[model samples]
Structures are given as C-alpha cells and as structure tokens.
Target: MSETDTDATATGTPDQRLHPWSWLFVLLQQLRQFIVPLLVLMFAGRGDHDAWPYAEYAEYAPLAGVLALVVVSVLQYFTYRYRIGAEGISIRSGLLQRNLREIPFTRIHNVGVHQSLLHRLFGVAEVRLESAGGNKPEGQMRVLGLQQALALEQLVRHHGSGAATTTGIAERPDGAAPAGQAEGRTLLSMPLGEVVRMGLVSNRGMLVVAAAAGLVAQASPERMMGNWLEQQVRGAAGYAEQLHLGWLGMASAALVLVAVAMAAIRLLSVALALSQYYGFRLIQTQGRLVVERGLFARLRTSVAPRRIQAWYQQETLLHRWFGRRALRIDTATGGGENDPRKLRELAPIATPAACEALFVHLLPGVQWPPAAWQGVPRRCWWRLFASSVPWTVLLVAVLWWHLGPWSLLAALWLPWSAYAAWQQAGRLGYVVDARLLAVRGGWWSRWWRMAELDKVQALQLQRSPLDRLLGTASLWLDTAGAGPLSPPLRIRFLPHAEARALHARLGRVLAARRMRW
Candidate 1:
C-alpha cells in the first residue's frame, strides 16, 4: 500500500541522495555539534602556551576545523542511502558499523517538509518522517526535488487509497521532479502586516539572552558576570573621580544599560519573528492539516485532523491590545516538528474571529462560544486572596530587610496581586453540555477549551485541604493527549456537590461514547 511506481528495484526502490546543497547542510550540522569540543581541542592542543597566553598554532585552528568539517560532510554524503517503496522506507548508513533501518509508513504519523534558503535556491526540499511513539524522527531525507518530496508524501499518505500525487509520479530520479514547491490548497495565511505585528509581540529577545547567558555560564565561572559588572562599574568611575562622581556615574551606567537592553530585546524580537514566521499558512486537506511556515527555514508539517486530541486559544496582553489571539491543537499521536506542545502556535497570531473559524474547521458539528458558563464560588476569590497576600507580604518583608524604606514599594505588589487574583477568578468557569465540556480561564487573556467526552481519558474530582476548608473542589479532565502549555481541562474552585454531579455526567458520557484514535 505504499506509494511506489512500476519502476522497480529489489533493494526497495533505488537509492536517493539529498540535493547537492545537502553537503552544506551536513557541514553546518557537523560544525555546530562539534564546535565546543573543537574549541576545547584547539585550546588544549596549545600544548602548554604559558609564555603568550595563547597557542602558537591558534592561527591555523579555524582552518583545521573547516577542513575537518569538509571531510565529515564528504563521508556523510557518500555513506547516506535511502529507498522509498510501497510499504515503507529503508535507510542504510554509518561508515564503520554499516547501520540499516526499515521504517513502515504505518508507524509514521507525521511528514514534515522543510526548505532552508539553500534548498529553496536549488528548488529542493527536505522530508522528515516522524512517529508519535518516539522523540526522534524515524528517518529524514536531507534534500529532494520539491515535486519528488510531495510525490513521496502522497505515496505514503494514499498507499491504502491507491491515489496518485498531483503529477501521478510516485517516484522520480533524484532531483528530476519538475521545478515546483509542493503546496496544498491554502486554508489560511497571515497577511504580512499581521506577521509584522506578531513579530513585535514575540519574545525572542529574552530567549536569545537566556541562551547566551547559559552558554556563558557553561563556559565560565558563575561569578564571572558579577565580577565583570563590578569591574565595569569601577572602570566607569575613574580613579581620580571615584568618590566625587561614583553615584552619578553608576546611575548613568544603569540607565544606559537598561536602555540598551530594551532596544536590543525589541530589535531581536521583531527581526527573529520576521525571519522565522514569514509566509505562514495553514492548509486543510482530506486527511491532513498542513501547516507551512518559516522564512529562512521554511517548514511544512502535515497532521491528521482526527489526530487532534484537544485545542485551546489564548491572547497575550500585547496581542490582546491589537485583538489578536494564538490557537493550538494537541494530538495523541504527537511528535515531530509539529508536536503541538513545542509549537503550540498553530495560529501564531490572528484575530479572535479567525481563531473561532479555525475552531469550527477543526471541530465541526460541535457547539462553540459555549452556551453557558457558571463561574467558581465566591470563596474561590477568598482562596485567591489568602494564597496571594501572604506571598506578597513575605516578599515585601524580604525587600524591606534588604533595602530599608525603599522596600515599602514592594508592598505595592499586594494590591496588584489581589487585583490580578480577582481578574483570574472572574475568568475561571466551567461548562458542561451534551457532547462537549469546556473550561474558561486565564490571566492576561481569557482562554476557553473544549473536548468531546470521547476524547477524555479520565476525570477526577478531589478536594484539597484549602478546598475542603472553603467547601470547594477541583475538577480535572485527563484527555488522551497533552497540550503545549496546559493539559486537558482543569477547573479549580467548583462547589463540592456541583463537581460531583459534573464528574458523574462526564463519566457516563465517556462510557457511552466510542472513542477515536
């Protein structure tokens, strides 16, 4: 049932190679993996450089690294071999051990297509075969003529259906498929303007900073940053004016640092977003929802609609100001570039109306904007206050101990915390209807989630010590799969009796329904 052409070979279809550009990819990947070790070796190989604080051969280190990468890439290109057949794929590689693997199409749950700028220049794409059962991809083709990639995808997807790809060629000689990027009917695509807005709202800057800090921490002492800051401060307040201008210099330095950090963060966030999320599109087909995105590294992931186990949409405070929300879906057979958890952004940034449309498309014949939502009990708010005030009070006390009167400003958090808790309580609610169950709640932006009874794996109604004191309970729903940020549906602070009733109702419904996988 695999997509295979009449052109036959006993070894399972003839061997295939990634596009010519694949050598560059191999080199980059190899360089990235070995960079740290290579650096360590470069430094170690100095062979005792106490005299100059550097290795005598350091000038050639970079050249040596480049040459090593070229050698590795050459070996990788010559050893890699993959064949596509009607039932599955066979991969053979490994210069020394001679590794071989045969992966069945049935075991693969996701097919991800990617095109970095290099591949695009060559009119080729990469295919990543993934299975929900593992953390790693089953196999991957570095580069294939774009059409061949699409045809191979078609062959695997419609193996049982006996359907041909758009061109009807199940297999093609490497790099021989015509010059077209495989694309499906576009279901939704963000406008460039919206893309820019989303880019502004993304927090890539913080991630970049965190990554840099982590690398620094790994490479040096933990106190290195503190010592560096002290040295800068000392240096900024020159020896002649150390006492007279110390405070002024420090204040100026602090302001400049803050301004620079903010500018860098904002600039990086926008640039990263623009580069990573340009030309984002979501397409719906007979059996798969194809998500295409990325500017430098274009990615296309195909997932089955039924594979979607749960979904939720949320808006960030920044996006909410512009009336945009992000939606994501969870799938049971989940793993790969499209694993709903990591890239919970199925719709990175779009209008609320767009989010609703996506919801309808994913779950038709289902009620949305849930008819009724009953909120948690008033004690929930009291619980919120009781839980928050102590932490805020302790924080204020700690700050006061360290900073004197200035610490009083920390108490400002108490009121703000209480206000936030109130807002959250207002948003938290539960809904139960014929076929669907939903929980609505969030802080900066409201979120509503729903799952069919058949999708629910388990239900729990339990009261914590605090809940028992408040005469309330928490209802937790365990769906078949986990989502990106949160799991199924969890409604805290439900009245005890109501929680029991809802649990029983869902339990009976789950028992009656025939679940799908």
Candidate 2:
C-alpha cells in the first residue's frame, strides 16, 4: 500500500490541510518562546510578599496566556492550507488577515524536515522550504504526517532539480525507498565513540556554560551573582587560612579547581554531542548531498554540489590530538546562514585521510591543501605590528592614568603584540589557479576557505591610507550564502599591482562564465 494513502489523499490539484495534531505542535512551539517569562510569573510572588504587587493576577496570567495560545494555534491550524501543483506549492495562511503565497520549485533552494521527540511520538514532522536571500522561510508547515511530509519534500526536490513530473503527487509503496533515502551512497557516518571524541575536541560545553552564565547574570539584576561570587571567595579564603596555605599551595588548589571544572565541562560536551550528532550520516545520491542526524530530534537536509558557493575546512590543536578535522560549506539556501537547519557540516568529525578523501571526491580537479601557497609580503608583518600600536598605546594610557607605576606592565604588550603580528603575517597565504582559489591563515587554529573561480559573485580591491603608503592592497571575493562564522575569502597585504592584476583576471573570468547557484 502507498504510504500517502494512509492519512493524506492526493487529488489532481486539491488543497491540503496540515496534520490533525498540528495545533498541539504549534502550541508547543509558541510556548517555547514564552517559557522563561511564564516560569518567572509562576514563581513571582512565592518568595516574598512584596516581590510583586499584582501577585493575585500573576498567578492566573500564565494559565490565561496558555489558553489564548491554544486558541491561536487552533485558528492557525484550521486556517492554513496548501495546494500542490506541478510547478510549485501555494500556501494560504493567517488568522486575522489572510495571506496567499506562491513559492515556485525553482526558487526553493533548501527543503528541511525536522522531527522532534514529540513529533516522532505522533509520527509527524515539521517542514521548511527556504529560498535564496530571505529574512524568513518561504514556506513553513508546522506539522505533517511523516509520509506526507516526505512526499512533499520529494515532490519539491524533483521539481527543483528540473525533473519532469506528470503529477504533483508523490506516491511510494511500502517496499519502495523513502523520500531522502533514494539509493544514496554513504560517505560518512559517526558511531558513538567518534561522537564522544568530537565532543571532547569541541568547545560546545564551554559555550553552553558561558550562555548559562550570561542568563544568570541577566536574571540577577540586583547583584545576586556578585554577592554569591563574593561569598564563595570568602569561603575559599577562610578554608585556605585554616589550612595555612602558602602561595604554592594556593596555586596548586587553583589548578585543581580549574581541572575539575574542565572535566565537568567535557562531560557536558559529550552529552550534548551525543544528543546532537547521534546517528549522523552523510550521503551522496542523485547528484545531491544528503545529511541526516540528531538523537531526540531528527533532521534531514540536502544540497546540490552546484548550489555550494564556498567551502571551509578547519583543524584546531585539539582536533590534531583527536586526529580529526571539520568540513563545512556555504550553500545558496536562505532564511539565515546561522540557521541550525542549514546543512553546513559535511564532515563534522573525520580523520585527516577521510577529509582529504572528501576533498578529492567533492572537488574534482582542484588541489587539496594547495602544494604551493603564495605568502604576503615580508613587510606585511611590520604593517600588522604598526596597526596594533594604537591599541597598545591606548591600553597603556588608560592604565597609567589609573595605576601610575603599575602601568609599566601594560607597556609589555607591544613586544608581545608585535611577535603575534609577525606570526600571523608569516602564516597568511593564498593560492589562485584557473579553476579554484584558496586562502588560509592562522597561528594556532588553522582554516582554509576556497571556492571555484566560477562561483565568485563579486570581486573587490581595497587600499587603506596605510596600504597606500606601504604599497599594498587587499583582495576580497564574495560568494552567495556566506555565513558569519566562516571567515570571508580575502587575501590581505598583497602587492598593489598583483592585487589589481588578480582582481582584473578574476573579474574577466566571472564575466565570461555563467554562474550557478
């Protein structure tokens, strides 16, 4: 039996409502945004009588808000309907003011299906269709039956890929391959041990801790955090005095505490990695790359190789120790580059050999880890050091005004800053060929950003007043879907004439070739 025959019926061109359980999912989604405030209201007056003057109203306000949310969800679920056609999907939604939206298959760059724990329980999933350069998703289906969602996704994917479809409906029998599992060759898969290693190599737990600390700081408007920290310090000092600890003992104790904290952080990181990357798989099928992952919530997303604009690769000291590396790509999908739904990570954690293999597979004819890197001019180091002088002077001036003699210590920053600048300039390098352009730079954590010459969207040559004096210029290559986290493909401190020549060459090449997404 066809899966679509279960709950959703495929007519020639009929409007379809979302799953019956959509309202509950919508309500849950809406509730998440107000969870913190609802929590605050729930405990507003319990601690102190004077905490809130309107405690009586606060007690019932959350309940009232929840009821309103439920009503809104119900209205939205009932009002929203979509019609599938051969070329595109038409969505009609909204409660107060009706909205009719038409999104063509060609315009949709990404199709994402997300299934959380709750969604899995009811055998439904959320679907998002993203277009290029949008502030919000083009089409969002809050909840749909898993099979129906898969069918919709398949239909969109087929139409987007320029495949000929006689009907808008997609039907799959029980023995047939599901939507995303269309006979793909597995490229990468992570087991539990590898995921654990990835967690250990990553700073996700530290980021979580920092975020929690920020939340605590934001919540404690009246210096509660400060008071708590002060109390802890006092308690530690008293204990040290009782032990008659000397400087060495105090240093050892601090080291121990730091180690303990790091251990805890690593444990938290492991748990988070397991939850996020459990059963992670990367597959290549039908000329598209597919990624599927998540523990409690599953995510499936795919992108065409031609749709990828730029590629990113990185390896930190920890990554080296773990014998792993990360690969990410910038695709033409919109909504937001930072959106978690974006399939950015091709290989979140892979061995050096595996990473190299991916480079060979994904980028045919392009060099992996360019054999020869053209370094910036030797004078670039002096230029970088000179740029730091103003900041160093500013720091010294502020410190001298505050501490007089102790400000001498701040003066030590200049030499260190110069050394750091020299190290950075020495490491900066780039490679450009007829087919590809790659740039890499870093002293400790190294990264490489590269893209095909045809993928270049814009080329810019910049020269500051200082650059003019030093006879240097910078070249920047812009591509579609560049994210905030990935550094731009820019090469700085090139000789002025070389920069101009490269810019002119790339501009001519880009002008001659037809660019894909």
Candidate 3:
C-alpha cells in the first residue's frame, strides 16, 4: 500500500475505511492469549478421578471446541473495528449485547508506544493512549509499525488544532524543540556504558529480601538450622567412635570447611541482586524521559514531562555521608503486577546542591521556597513520638506473649522507634513559593518532593482527634496519579492556623489561574 493509503487506514479518519485483516488479527491475538488456559483446563479435567474419561466424549469435544473458537473469533472480529471522527474515536463490540465507546481527543493525557520481543521481530508495536478522566476512559489502539506509531501520535495530538477546533487546549508546537532540550538531551541513543552503570548501582534491597524469602521457603525454616547442626553432630560422633585422634582432627577440619561453605551460600543469596538488575539505562527522549532496565527480561517505560506529578530528591544516612542524593520522579502510569512504574530514578546519586538546578533545567517554571520557609516546627517531633507509643507497646506485648522470656529483647524496638520518629520529624519541611510547593520528610531515608502549584488538583487541611487536642493539623495535597504518585504534596504537622492559611493561599492561587485561563 502507498504511504498515504497506509496512514489513512492506520488512523481511520471519518470517511476512511479500516484494513480488512485488522479485526481478524485482533481475534487471533485474543485466541492466542486464551489457548493455554483452555488446554490447562482440559488436562485438569482429564486428571480428575471422578470425571468421565475424555475418550467417552472425544468425538463431540473436538467439534465443540472448534465451533466455540469460530463463534468467539467472529464476535471479536466484529467488535475490533474502530473509527476516528473529528471529535473522538469510536469503538464498537460485543456479541449478544453490542456496546459502543467514544473517547474525545481532548481528554488524552499521553500516548505510549510499547514493543515486545515479538513485536520487534514483527516490526509492529502497541500504542496505548491514556486519558486524564481516570482509567475507565483510556483505550489501546494496537499494532502499528514504528513510523506509523509516530504519525498516529502526532495526528492525535494535532487533531483539533485548526478552524474546526472547539477545545481550549492548544496543540503542542510542531517545530518547537522537544521538552528536555535545555537539560542535556539524551536521545534514543544512549551510551551502553551508562546503561550498565545504572543497573549496577540501583538499590537491590527488595531483591535481597525476595531471595531470602524464597530460600527460607525452600529450606523448611523450622528445621533448617537444626537439621544442619544435627548432621554435623552425627558426623563428629561417628568420627570420635573410630578412636583415631588424627582422623578426628581431620574430620574437625572438614567441619570448619563446611561452615565456611554454608556462610558463602548465605552471602551469595544477597549477591544475586547484582545479576538481576544488570544493564539499566536512563535515557532522555524528545518530549519525555525513558528508563530501560533489567537482566533476564528487559523493561522500558517512558514518562512525559507533563505527566510527572512530583519529583523527589532522596538521601539515606549513607547517601548523606557520601554527599549524594537520588532523584526519583513519580508519574500516573501503572507498570502492571510484578513491576512498579511509580518512582523512576533519574540519577542514582548526585549532590543535593545540584538537584534543584538539574530539576529546573529539565522541568522549567518550578520554584522552590526561600530558605526561611524550609524550617519545620519543633513540636512535630513530640507528636511523632507520642503517636508511635501505642504501636510500639502493642508489638512488644505480642512478642513477649508469643516468644516467652526471649522476647524481652523486643523492648529494644521502642528506643529505635523513638529515634526514627525524632529523625523523621527533623527531616520534615515544607516550602511554599510563588510557583510550587515542596514537602520533605523521612528518617533514615530522606525525601523532598516538589509539585507545581498550577498542577495541584485538590488541597485539604484535616485534624484527627489527637491532632485537634494538640493544636496541630495535617495538610493533604492530591495531584493526578494513582497511589504513591498521588501522595499529599505536603503532609507535615503544622499549627492549625498556619495550615488553614496555607490552604487559603493555595486556593487563591488556583482560582487566579482558572480566572486567567
């Protein structure tokens, strides 16, 4: 097909028609996804002792399976054809009950291109279009070539820009340089060395925990150490029974060797993290940032500048001692079950003084509060300490009851909790300036998150019974995202009056922007 014809077919304009094979492809894709599950069920049914042998129904079963597949495939084919009109995209599908979905072009937040190993081999990729009106309205427009994907993204972006336009949101400038230009733009082209470095330095504490859990499960925790000890004692007793001092000494030496080997195996469990997170890369795309990492199965995620709800500069005690901070940006996208796309580390480690400069260059118009606004109140520490007491006491009591006299050691947690609370309170700080609001907190691991004032979706000031009694209130700031990315922009314990004043100030700022628009 000609390029123009291909574009028209891929985009499906109001007057244009879809490819004849599009619906067929969708049906096949759905069938492929279901085939394995169907086979597993068939096998499971055959294995059941109470169930009749498949041989009894074999003749009808094959025919029934074939008929079922045909009917489902036909229904899916009819449902998969989608059309693009001037206002929005329309999708129609369903078997007995037909359903139609229409999504306006204006509601689209970002368009993502996803290519799997199979897709790369086939020279096609999936295009996922996400909208701001929650997850329900979002849709996937699938399987297009690399060039076609780019054209579709541009077409959707520029659909309503001309005289027919009714939406107020302006089209992104065509010739304008991509968003991250001034901030040291890295292209689809990233150095292999940097990618390898990123993977090595990433925090693998979670991986270590996961491996430990897996090993504990496999070794039978209740008898694991005792079994090893018993084996050692039996071997020593057997050697002692031989009544040769030289042989006994040699056996003792062998026990020392076994001890060293066991210690090495335990150490290897943590070291396995190095192999899993290998070959990670942080690349700056034209209009977004891209992170590609993983060893066995690689993962790639791209986040647009506009979709970033908050940016966090984090530093643990070790990081602070090393004069380094990690930059993490939270976006609204979901990364599926095993993976998390919440906070993508931009730089694994960098100086705190350089963080703001790098942030401003990447995302323009972000403002930080003056030095005076950075101080958190001293009373916050007392509140944290008081709030932790109940939980600490309950935990200690449970340990004492369940673990007997040995559990008295759990009392040590009380002092640790107190220290953590004190440190967290000290780290908590809020910065409100002309253009943004930044919240900072965390005990051993420090975090400073800044969100643009204009992007603030909602702001709330609340007080619990205890907070009210203490004359302090908590502020909640909600932005556009799911879970952690949707964290309160600021949640520090502040004086009731001060919290109210801050809320009012933010409300006024939002009101003024709305009025201007």
Q: RMSD of each candidate?
A: 5.5, 5.3, 8.0
- lDDT accuracy of residue 23 in candidate 1: 75
Instruction: Name the weakest run of 10 consecutive residues (lDDT summed) in model 1.
Output: 1-10
The residue-by-residue lDDT of candidate 1 on 369-410, one tens digit each, is 776788886546656767777877788789887899898888
> Cα deviation of 130 in candidate 1 (Å)?
1.2
Position 173, candidate 1: lDDT: 48
Query: Which tens-of-lDDT digit does each residue in 372-473 have in candidate 3?
Result: 445568657766787777876787779887888777787777788778887887778788878878887787877777888777778888888987887888
TM-score of 2: 0.86
True lDDT of residue 126, candidate 2: 93
Best by TM-score: 2
lDDT order, best first, reads 2, 1, 3
TM-score for all predictions?
A: 0.81, 0.86, 0.68
Candidate 2: clashing residue pairs, number? 0
Candidate 2's C-alpha runs over 4 A off are: 1-13, 33-65, 94-97, 164-181, 387-416, 514-517
Model 1 TM: 0.81
